[model samples]
Target: MTPETSDNRTLPWFARPAARTWRCPPAPAAVRDFHASLPDYAPTPLIELPVIADELGVGRLFVKDESSRLGLPAFKALGVSWAVHRVLAERPESGDGAAPGPVTLVTATDGNHGRAVARTARRLGLRAHVFVAEGVHPRASAAIAAERAEVTLVAGSYDMAVRRAAEAAAAPGVVLVQDTAWPGYERIPGRIVEGYSTLCAEIDEQLAAADAGPPGLVAVPVGVGSLAQAVVTHCRSRAAGPSASALLSVEPRAASCVLDSLLHGEPVSVTTGETTMAGLNCGTPSSLAWPHLRDGLDAAVAVTDADSDRAAADLTALGLSPGPCGAASLAGVRAALGGEGADGRRATLGLGPDSTVVLLSTEGSEANPVRVTGT
Candidate 1:
C-alpha cells in the first residue's frame, strides 16, 4: 500500500514491502566484548508464547523479554551503559590513571534512555544531565532524578530536547551519549547502536539453547531505529541462523518516522504529537540507523495508541506486563497477520502456519502509567 492509504483511525495501520533485500552484518566486537566485563551483564529471557502463537495461528511465538535489563526496567540500559563507557574510556584523561573527577554524561530522552544513562553515570562515579521533553511521565523523570541525574524539561517535542542536550554536551567535561545521530556527531551514537547488538546476540543464544530454530519473522519496535538496526546487524552476521528471516518493523502511528522514511526513500521527520507509546514516539529516524533500516527491513507497520494499549493488556494477561512501546511488536504482528490486507501482505512475506514469529518486548510497564483505550 502507498503512504497515502493511512486513515489514522482507532487502529490505524499501514504496511509496505521493503525496497531491498534485508541483510545482517557482523556485530561490533569491541562493544560486545566490553559489555561482557560489566557486572550487570546477563542474557534477558526469550520467552515462548504458545498461547499467542495458537491464537495467531502461527507455528510458534517468542518474546525477547527485556523488562529487567541490567537492573533497569528497559533495554535502554544496554545501549546507554555501553555508550557511556565507550565515551569515558576513550577520553584522553581516562588513560592517565587520575581520578576522572565530575565527568557528566548527557542525553535527551522520553524516559528509559535517560534513566539508564543516569543509572550508568552514577554507577561509574560520574554525573549525568538528562534533558526530557515536556509531557514526560513523572515516574520516568523521578527515576532519572533518583539516579542523581539533573533532569531539564524542554518545552516542546522530544526533538527539541535532543537539540538542547546537544547544546549542553558541548560544554567541557560533558559527553553526549545519545542513541540518535545527526551529521558530524556519529561516533557516540554509532557506539550506542553497536551496544544494542548484545540483545540480539542474547536472543540468538537463548533460541539455540531451546532448540527453537531461528525466528522466521522478527517484529521489532522502532523509534529512532537503533535497536532494530542492531538486531538486523547481529542476525545477518550469524553464520548459522535465519538469514532469510523477514523483519517486520513497527512504530507508533503518531510518530512513524521510520515508516515515513521508508515510504519516502529518505529520512524525513514527522510531527510527533502525544502518544501512549512514548518510547516509539520519535519524529525522526536516527541518521546512523536510516541506511540500516532502509536496506535491512523487510516490511514496516504503524500501530495506533489503542492497538498499543490492547496489546499491552494482552501481553499482561500472558504474564508479560509490557509498556506501550514494548507491546508494539505484538500489535504490529496482529496488524500484519490479522488486520486489513493481511492475507496479501502475509503472502508477500511468506508468513503462514509454519512460520515462527519473534517479538522484542523492549520494556516493562513501569515508566508509563497512563492507560489509553480504543474508542
Candidate 2:
C-alpha cells in the first residue's frame, strides 16, 4: 500500500541541542551497584508496526514494549524499585530493610511510581506509605497495597495528592522517594531519571536486532517528563543522524508541561487537565527532569484522549497488550503523520520509509487494566 501522508502546517517547536548535565554522583554506591546487578535491567523488547508504519508513510515503526517489563508489567517498576531499594540501602542503620517501622517511604503517584516504590519496599524489607488521588485506579492502589505499603487515597487532583505526599515527607522518620521534585526534594526524582536510563540501554540492543536499526523519530510519553528525559538524553548522547532524527515528547493536551516549558524556556505549571491516561496527567515536569527534556528533546506534541483510545485499540489489534497511558506515543506518532493533524480527530504523525520511528510503550494495562473512555 502506498502510505498516504500529511504535513503539519504549524511546525513543532524545536528544542535547541541541549546537552545532558545529569551528575552520576556518588551517593549510594552499594545500592547503585546492587541496582546494576539486578540482571533484570535488560532493554525489554522493541517490535515493528509494519502496517501502521507503512500506512503512515514511515520507513519502520518500533515500540519498546514495556507491557512485560520486569514481569511486573510496567516501566515505572524500573525507577520506583530502584529508588526504593537505594533509599533503604542508604539508611542501613534503619535496621532490617524489611518490616514496617516508624520510618515511612512516602511519595505521590498517578499509579506506576507508587507500585514500584511499594514493590521495592516489600521486596527488600522496608515500610512504604504511598499517597494517591482519590480517583486513581483501584487496581493501582491495590497493587501498591499488595506490596504491604499503606496506601492513602487523597481527595482532589494529582497535584493535591503530591502536596500531601510532600507534607508527609517532612515527617522526621519519613523519607520521600518522589518521582517529581520540588523545593529541596530532588534526589528521589533524580534516581527516577537514572533508573529510567536502563530502558535506553535495553532499546539500543533491541533496535540492533531488528535491522531496522536505530529509530529516526522517537515518540515518548511525558508526564512529569522524567522518562522522556532519560530516553532523549541517552538516545541523543549515543545515537543520532538519519536513524535518529527527532526525539518527540507526547503529552496529554490538558497537562502539557514539557511542551509549555520548551516553548517558554521555563518550568511553568498547568491546571490538571482531565485524561483517561491518568498516569500522564501531570501539569508540571519534574524540576530534575525539566533540564534534560528542554535540552535533549527535539520537539513536543499534545495528544488527546480520543487519540490515545484509538492507539490502545490499535495496539491491542497488534496482539500487544497496552493500557491507555501505555499506548500514548502511538497516538502522537499517528498525529504527526497527518497534515493539519494538530486540529483533526484522525490525524497522524509519520516519517519517510527510511525514517525508522520508535514509540516508547512506557507503561501497561496492569496499573488500570480497564480504561474509562475519556473525552
TM-score of each: 0.92, 0.84
RMSD of 1: 3.3
| RMSD of each candidate relative to the true structure | 3.3, 5.6
In angstroms, give how far residue 83 of model 1 lies from its true place. Answer: 1.4
Off by over 4 Å in 2: 1-36, 39-43, 92-103, 239-245, 341-351, 369-375
Candidate closest to the true structure, highest TM-score? 1
Pairs of colliding residues, candidate 1: 24-236
Off by over 4 Å in 1: 1-24, 94-101, 238-243, 371-375
Q: Report the C-alpha lDDT of model 1 over 204-249, residue by residue, as the tens digit.
A: 7888887878788889999899998887777655543234677889
The Cα local distance difference test for each model comes to 0.82, 0.72
- Write down the worst ten-residue block by lDDT for model 1: 4-13
lDDT of 1 at 19: 28
Model 2 C-alpha RMSD vs. true structure (Å) is 5.6
Q: Residue 215 of candidate 2: its Cα lDDT?
A: 67
